[model samples]
Target: MSLFSTPFDPARDTALVTGAGNGIGRAIAQALVGEGVRTVFADISAERVSAAIGASKRPELAVPWVGDLAELDACDALLATADAALGGITHFVHSASPPRREADHALAVDRRIWQQMHAVNLDAGFHLARELAKRLIAAKRPGSFLFLTSLHAGTPRNLPHYSTAKAAMAMLVKELAKTFGRHDIRVNALVPGAIAAGGVRRGSRAGAAHSARASRRGQ
Candidate 1:
């Protein structure tokens, strides 16, 4: 009846968010829960994950899943958990990233930092997106996926590791978009500007933006 009205319901949909124990991931998961969507909080911190699960208003709607998303196998486990807990997921939010601070810029950056950055951000996102895409394809289901990217997805910051990963992540978004568009799956990155309050502020921004966008899409 309306341009924004969905024939299907979004509140009834399930959403999976990686790194949802704290910061951006936590915020995004909370937002999805606030929208009445079944939200799965996946993170490496069992304590924080449990806390988030306990803090939810609809505790039944917010399921906690703890694991290292950088490991591709974790995605399968998470999917299984979500499948059992919420039936199936129709949305995914990639909110995982390696530790970052102004102090970790190029002059002080080491190879380990670089590798960890790629492992957590770039590789995890690719693996999650790819695995979820395969599931959607095999099930003949359509879904939406959003990546918590930075403005660096276009312009580079002094953090070469973070910037390069974000840049590659942008390309990953495009690649997925091209491949999945025909299947009615939507893939896009949320590019946030410099939020000075650190990852907390960034997380809040991401949650707010994703909630607004999801509301607009009725998802």
Candidate 2:
């Protein structure tokens, strides 16, 4: 057996996946279910949330909730809902991001974009992880946190809001990793490239909007 054969058993663990409505978030939530881990699928869309649970393939251990995670209250609400549904959340996967269309670059991008991006991408992500870490640390329980960051974090795409939030998230991961490492809690960021996942779909209005926005940003 490998030295790191298993950090935790899926059957005994629970996971929370935000933005689980579609795309990469959907993919990850589905995979977690396949691993036999109890999962709570949360999104801002009620229809999508219901759809995710109904189509879970295995609803025995999966739950769904419509949540606006950008709202600070929703963060606590989600954790409470998950804890009630699955006893306790041992794993957290923050895949939810306030839609990052190819709009509002450094010049045209207003504070609106920055506020929304920072709220969901960095503030909520870090707060959730830190809050969970505090609980686990006090209880002397081991846990893991996985954040979805972008490769564009360090690189400049002119989307100051997005890039800045991603950078902060990276630092959040690093800080959490160092602070919680001693408590047996693992914190890591999944820096993804231009994968066809996320919220935007190709050839759709949203897709076109994103492209138009990006084009306006001078590619």
Which candidate number maximizes lDDT?
2
For every candidate in turn, the CA RMSD to the true structure comes to 7.4, 4.8
Give the deviation of candidate 2 from the true structure as CA RMSD.
Answer: 4.8
Give candidate 2's whole-model lDDT: 0.79
Cα lDDT tens digits for candidate 1, 1-219:
322345436645788998787766777787677667788898888998888777766667788888876676876788789889887778989988766755667898789878877887888888777777787888888899998888887786778988999888888899999998898889988887744223421235666676566557654
- TM-score result, candidate 2: 0.84
Which candidate's TM-score is highest?
2
- After TM-score superposition, the amount by which residue 142's alpha carbon in candidate 1 deviates from its true location, in angstroms, is 1.6
Q: TM-score, each model? A: 0.79, 0.84
C-alpha lDDT values of all predictions: 0.78, 0.79
